[model samples]
Target: MQRSEMPSINTQERLLAWALVLVCVALLFAQAPHGGDFYWSDSPRHALNGVFVMDLAKAMPFDDPAGYAYRYYAQYPALTILFYPPLFYAISAPFYAVLGVSHETALLVVALHYLALGLGCWRLARFWLPAAPSLAFAALVLWLPEVAFWGRQVMLEVPAFAFLVWSTVAVVAYLRGAPPRWLYLGAALLVLGMYTKISVAYMGVVYAALIAQRDGWAMLRNRHHWWVAALALVGLLPLAVLTLKFGQANLQSVTGVADAVASRTSWQGWVWYLQQIPSQAGWPLTALGLAGAVMAAWRRMPGLGFWWLGFGVGYLFFSSIDLKEARHSVFLLPSVTFFAVLLLHTLVPPRVGHGAVAALALLVLATAGLTVWTRPVFYVQGYARAAAEVARLAPRDSTVMFSGYRDGSFVFNMRALEGRRDLHVMRADKLLLGVAVRRELGVEQKGLTEGEIADALNANGVHYVVMQPGFWADLEAMQRFERVMSSDQFEEVARISTPANHKAHETELVIYRNKGAVTPRRRGIDIELKIINRRISAD
Candidate 1:
């Protein structure tokens, strides 16, 4: 190849990269929920929090009187504030104000972030791949089900990733000697990423490793390195303060309360993530990524070692954590995709022609399409209709108990979306009931009998109960449910049944009204009766 031809090749590649990025952005927008609603149990809650932050920013009351009200057993009886980094909410707040705090508005904000993610991916890939292939690779990474599906939601996963990738690109530019300003910019972005989600802190580790690899101990002598560190510390101070204040509650929120128990350091967790990669990233991309990583490592490619390190360290760190989730490892997706693009570029020999390169690009697009096609469209369906029904049927200022696996969805939809702030939707699980009893009723009873629970519900002014079929799956819960049904203190009100779909579990939300109690609060009577029965049985 002539040296003069290199400029033409580079220009053409740059143009193709931009063109591919635009196409990916268009596809992402197309898949987003424009007019229709897509449901996630967590999204409405996050959306509500964003609106709350927006209100606070505007000097309005942070709490909405007409919003769904639930006692935060973890805190006080307050509007639900998802214990997450506030950056996503802070960013989405203005959109909430302009869009009237609807799901569509939240999704639109996410769509914008998705576009930003595409651009970030392109810039990050350009460090390794030529301009044209880098653009296609960016589109492929953006189109991955792991990215696209979450990118459309109100969750912080994609938003944090957007910052993390850009930070990565800026860091690369700095290391390559563009300017010291890029290093500072990278620090700021890392801080921003941490604000969005703490998981992005892994990038800091990757960045340090990259520096250590490039300059060894000598990199520490650079004044610019010290400046970046100081800037990052300053940026991360707010998050550190939040961590100190919230402590374990914030950790529990991110890892999930249930995961605190279920997650363990096991190969099973590692295997689970490994299995998700092929589906999440697509088989073709995963294979190519593996090949590229091996090739890059075999040749000891400069500045490319961080990609492998990032993936390896990220996978190990996340998988080793007690709380394991597929999404927790999503930070590695871009690294994997980057390596995959490199392998694809290497596959076509200079003599083998551009057709081979085009075929590889086509293969990536096809795999992305397959992934999108197979991925579930909604996280939880039929929630909007059920929420509307609750809003319509239930009396204003009445408490509605939700006894279901997906109670969060009901709580979010009824309160967050429908603006049914007058209704207090309580999850009727034993753990929740225990907390409610202590907080709302000033009772500290544990292991309350079914009758005792029923009495407490009546005394607490809980007017309606909504139970799904899955709620009755537990033997004890089912027994209690039957007892509640047979009691004269409650009457069935409404039954909402939604057929199982590709994305959502089949649900039967049964609403029951509390019939006025014929007797005084059972308080300690059931416990006494149980003690007496125990003695009698022993005799």
Candidate 2:
């Protein structure tokens, strides 16, 4: 290459990098106007963990953080942070403290992951193709309806996916014998990915197998591998402790769900994800990815080969589990993207005119634009307003009980109070219903009786009641609770109406003020913790 050509090549690389930046930034702005309320049930729960971490940080209690954590859980039963890993919360705490916790803060944290993922996609794709082609592929990956689906909400998939992408990039660099730090970096990212979501642990197997296949088993004897393994063990220590204490619910959920799903499906169970690929990913890319996979394995493109291995193992592993979801197959997107880009890059010969290559790039960018611009988006409202009204009416440190499908939204909004951290938020679904993770809800045990519920509410010093008809219209719990709230013991203070849209179901919430309440008694938080524990561990 002539010296004159070098400037143009560098300029093209910089332009492509900036293009990827602009594309990812556009996605960040896409989620900004939701008023910090969530649609998905789990999204708010994930966001709450961040709030919990920041609250704990501010408290900086000299005594026992573990005790603080327990009392906090007793206060907010919607919190299942114990069931999942803590890495996301750790990442989110600084953002919460700095910007204040809201849906926006959570989405911003997810946006960082999205932007990092776009970077990883660019770096990984650029390894195999030219700058313009790489940029196109990364943009498409970000635009995949599936990626954007989880991307907008504060879920673990995009965050875990981000870690997987960067980890793969580092591992690929290490595979080419770039540097030792790349190896450790890959290991750290893999561990981080697992901590972000346990589903990514299979990726560790993907890494090991790729390395061993590349360098032979003698690579196992390398001291660097041993050192990284030791570091990984230390990194996983917190998970080990959490698993011992709170993992029963997760384990039961997986196995019990697997058993249930296995009974319902036939031969389609194995091929369910493959069938949905065309919809989740576009049909054109799906066909290209298949062809690309065949060509790459036939020609033996090493990095593409690594992703090929990933797609195979990820698909088989997730499919073999009795439960199935389209999101579970998200890891396959990289392999699909790799293959599709490789095919296009292969089609366009290197000697082709720059104008022709530029046209290909424009086509991909246009497709990405269509994906982002045309996709429909909706978010829930009313929770933030309801939370504000409750916070304003209830006294500080008073317990506010909520009963609804999206108690997570309610709890998350309540926790947003920077100074009113003392307010104890309770979920009626968790306390009155005692719905264990493994048991089918509304089928097993009946909820607390009205008299029992009244005594329990008064005994706990309940001052505010936020109830919605989250159950069947005739559900004894909903009916009995309504009867109790409507009685002279309580007065309807507010009727907050929430309109249904997307994941946010429509319902009328009646917030009641306890009129006959006295300076009632308070139960030990530990006793509440024990009751909560039974909901998790029992099948």
Candidate 3:
């Protein structure tokens, strides 16, 4: 505690902190070259949202979402629509301001935003741990295969996760009894997080509860802090209105999403989640997290305790839903990261703190290096190329269908080709996909037969069917078509030959000619005439 020792202590801490931060920055920048994975529906959708926002800012571009497709423009969740448009648009502003909205330039700008967000996570981690330890933790969370898997690729996660960490840091600082300014800052970050993604709203409550548990809930009754809470609510009002107004358009549709997610009560859902845990967190990390959760609860650390609860609920929701996806659980990543770091921090003895820090830093470096080595960034580029190819091969006004929502590949392709004037695209129904399978397999499924596919194709004016056969080949249509467009589902259909990797069979891409306008099979009178005609023909 002598003045002489104080300087050395300060110097050592400063040296360690800067060293870790530099490592974190290096890892993020290394992965920067391989931008987003656009093949997935959500990734490009988000990229385009940023693109469109900037496009409008340029000179009020008329390419509205409504004119694109029903679901394309349709209201679903307010997370990406209202919040990201403005958030990422602002992020993209400098790039667009300089680059002038060219597709390549715009995407490069978005990529920079990803880099900035990654660095922000690194900075936040430093506040919780010493610079070296924090950077190591940031690297682990940022470079996790799933983090790169979900993070850089777009979706509400990256921005949402960034704000989640920001708010958490604020709350922790406040709990550590920092100045009121820190609490206000936490409130502001929480507001932005909620605006970007609503699930984080629950996080604010959890954080507030943690604070109350620490300083006593009686403090919450004070008047001065009311403004902090008020400002948070005020910032979120625009998104709240958007959700309400959009949901009002079709009450059933809005409820259906939540209902659909809730309806998947199968035991298989649980099993699927259990199966995913090892791949996502890695067994070692998951075990560490569980230990961390138990230790926090045992010590009655409410911040960590409440976080554990939120993480558990979030993961359960992730597993049970019909829409089970890695992206849905993106909000939970911060909690997982926090607990993992907390466990390491708590379990390791202070005498060997330097060793623990070094070990963690090494682990992060190894994992991030592996992730970059194996990560899939080509998916997005593939999609962008496929969209361009589709614009070329098929005739003008050729109606194209992508069998599944393979990363909204078709949607982005269509969007990229806005001025074509000759092309239209629609998603093929699952039943039609089944029909393709039945035809190819020569297996009779009750509704999805060859006749159904013929009818559906005709009805939609589908002149060309563009698909990554390997991904959706199991569908009867892909089996029936026997035309391989892009060989791998993960690979782009354009400019690349399908790899030798065959499904049980190969589904080929076919351009079926539409001989005539498709007429709907009307009910009642039409059914009666069809029945009579069949009888007359038999007689």
TM-scores, all candidates, are: 0.81, 0.88, 0.65
lDDT of 1: 0.65
Candidates sorted by lDDT, best first: 2, 1, 3
Worst 10 residues of 1 by lDDT: 530-539
Model 2, 1-539: lDDT tens digits are 00111112376676767676666657545754466457777888899998888888889966877667767777766677777888998999999889987888988898888888888888877556667677777877887767777777888998998998899878777776667799899889988988898788787778788778876888788888888879988998898788768876555544446344442245777778788777666767778778877887788665455766788888777776655667777878877876777777776665666653664565466555555564434566778888888888888668888877778888888878666767787666555554545334223335688888887787777899888755544557667777888788998888888764554555677788987654543656433333126422210
Displacement of residue 220 (Cα, Å) in model 2 is: 3.4
Sort by TM-score, top down from the best: 2, 1, 3
TM-score of 1: 0.81
Q: In candidate 3, where is summed lDDT lowest over 10 consecutive residues?
A: 530-539
The 10 consecutive residues of candidate 2 with the worst lDDT sum are: 1-10
Per-residue lDDT over 1-539 for candidate 3, one digit per residue giving the tens place of the 0 to 100 score: 00111111256654554555455545554444232224444555565565555544654535744332222332111113442324654565566557543345545554444454555555555544555555556667766666676654455666666776777666666666667788888888877776656656667666666666665777678664787888877887877776554433222322323434333566765666555654565555666767777777788774244456557666665554464555556566656666677787767776775766756755666666666666634342344445566667666555666654353444644665547635656544333332211132233233444555666655655555655445455655555543322222122334333222212122233233344444432211111111111111100
**Residue 96 lDDT in model 2?**
88
What TM-score does candidate 3 get on C-alpha atoms? 0.65
Candidate 3 structure lDDT: 0.52
